[model samples]
Target: MGDGDRRLTVNGSLRSVPANPPRSLLDVLRYDLGLTGTKYGCGEGRCGACTVLLDGVPVNACQIPVDEVGDRSITTVEGLASRGELNAVQQAFAELGAFQCGFCTPGMIVRATALLRDDPSPSETEIRAALNGNLCRCCGYPRIVRAVERASEIGRSGGGRP
Candidate 1:
């Protein structure tokens, strides 16, 4: 609770990273905590490759300073699994081929997870709007949208894992 002592929960675990210079949450997650699934792209936060959940909402980790993390719970891509099994969204992404290079997969999955958590049955337009922030260079936009639709169905069948 003193200066430079900041604590936050990530992937269901608590982390106490330093806040002296206030490193980006992305750096804390990847460098300090060894969670590399959250990728680094367009450090400006426009690419959404460093997306993660902050208190159940999707955010660009690169845009958030570690000191600002405070006590919020951050969910990385690694936290998507439940009991060692892939969650509905993850499975949908895999089965539906939502990604090609896979570099942006983690962020896409995390953002989609948040979207599904908020609305399990989002329409195509809703899915597109939700994913507007995330970009994939492989041009797999259609597949990505299909994957979201599949995840929605799976979630409706009680297959989603927070």
Candidate 2:
């Protein structure tokens, strides 16, 4: 289907957005839908700042087209929380002070959320690997890693995945 004809579920809601077929999912999410939580760090997808979950797997929103996302469930950083409660990864980032300047935190948290969902008991190495696509200029990698680890623990302990 054409970009303007594409429809998908975003953050648990259905949205029919307009795009240019080549337009990135990042643009549709941010400009078309106003889900600005997903940042645009590296347009090349080298940075995870534009990360979002496509069917619960972390993918660079900057690399995917709106037409390619038809009928799939897309979860942006804005969807991570609900009803005024933060998700586990968000809480972990806050408790562990995982961000500086906070530009990359949203993508990091979204990626971490996927990691925890796939493996609620990932080791430090696994966490690092999962977050390899994301880059933080603030040099907050250490704390971000710890936050993922903590979020994993929280999930394992039946904390409702935050």
Candidate 3:
């Protein structure tokens, strides 16, 4: 096997690509696997538009090296839905109009999913803290917060599942 040939498992699919060793996970995900749901708002890690779950933890895809991902399970917005059913957070976002431009919706939903998984009932402050890394330029944070809260309530009441 050549040095450039690397194996990456993304969104439950395994793929082999001729990627440079230093290539970021964002590049591999977008260019190689065609998972464009993860956006590239800022090359740096400040913006969470490029966020994806590496082993269920939100991380900046632009800052993660493909080679370093190894056997970790990567989950992007594409994986949030299953069999034509949207996840709870996604449905909440859609119902509440949590996003304006939709550029940051994927990352926000991903982070909110993680938050809900960790805390079934999170206070507004806890939700804000959980989503601190993700930024929305459209200034839709209030609705986003409301969406997360609603999702939590729906989840607890067993109404979040599709």
Candidate 4:
């Protein structure tokens, strides 16, 4: 690593953080690395729209400093797919039309991905509780919950994996 350059693992690939890196991981992921799938909603940790997997845990990228990231692995929404196929959660969301405006879909999917990875069969209440921090203005919570349930089924069937 150079004076102002940092290195980290992103989407299973080793990458170099931009020189004079931006303050927040969100900015670096979007502007510096062109990983724009992580949305910028509230610019605060309150909104989970900037959620991403940092070391396999969902975090509000807007609140994580670039320096604090160090060499941790970061996975954006774009990283959920494999072999040109969407992951279980993403496919379930798409098949069920869980999103309305689509602005919060990426964050929701990223968070859901982590949830399913940790617990493949989360109950409806557990799903809601897990997604409490991620707000959807279009009132798509019903579809979102159903999609997660469907994703659990898919995951169990080995049709899709998170």
Q: Which candidate number has the best lDDT?
A: 4
Q: Which pairs of residues have clashing backbones in candidate 4?
A: none
Give per-residue CA lDDT, model 1, range 1-162, as digits (tens).
Answer: 567677788878777777667689999899988999999999998999999999999999999988777788899999989788999989999888788899889999999999988888899999999999999988899999999899889888887663
Q: Which is the leading candidate under TM-score? A: 4
| Model 3 error, position 65 (Å) | 0.9
The predicted structure with the larger TM-score, 3 or 4, is 4
How well is each residue in 49-90 modelled by candidate 4, as lDDT tens digits? 999999999999999988898778899999889879999999
Counting clashing residue pairs in each candidate, in order, gives: 0, 1, 0, 0
**Candidate 2 residue lDDT tens string, 63-89:** 997778877899998998998788889
- For model 2, the local distance difference test gives 0.87
**Which stretch of 10 consecutive residues in model 4 shows the poorest summed lDDT?**
14-23
lDDT of 3 by residue, 54-159 (tens): 9999999999988789889999999988888888899899899899999999999999998998889999999999999999999899999999999998788897
The lDDT for every candidate, in the order shown, is 0.89, 0.87, 0.89, 0.90
61: Cα error in model 4, Å:
0.1
Model 4 CA deviation exceeding 4 Å by range: 1-3, 19-22
Q: Point out the higher-scoring one by lDDT: 1 or 3.
A: 1
**Candidate 1 has which clashing residue pairs, if any?**
none
Report the Cα lDDT for residue 21, model 2: 47
- Local error of candidate 2 at residue 102 (angstroms): 0.5
Which of candidates 1 and 2 reaches a greater TM-score?
A: 1
How many residue pairs clash in model 3? 0
The alpha-carbon deviation from the true structure for residue 83 of candidate 4, after best TM-score superposition, in angstroms, is 1.7
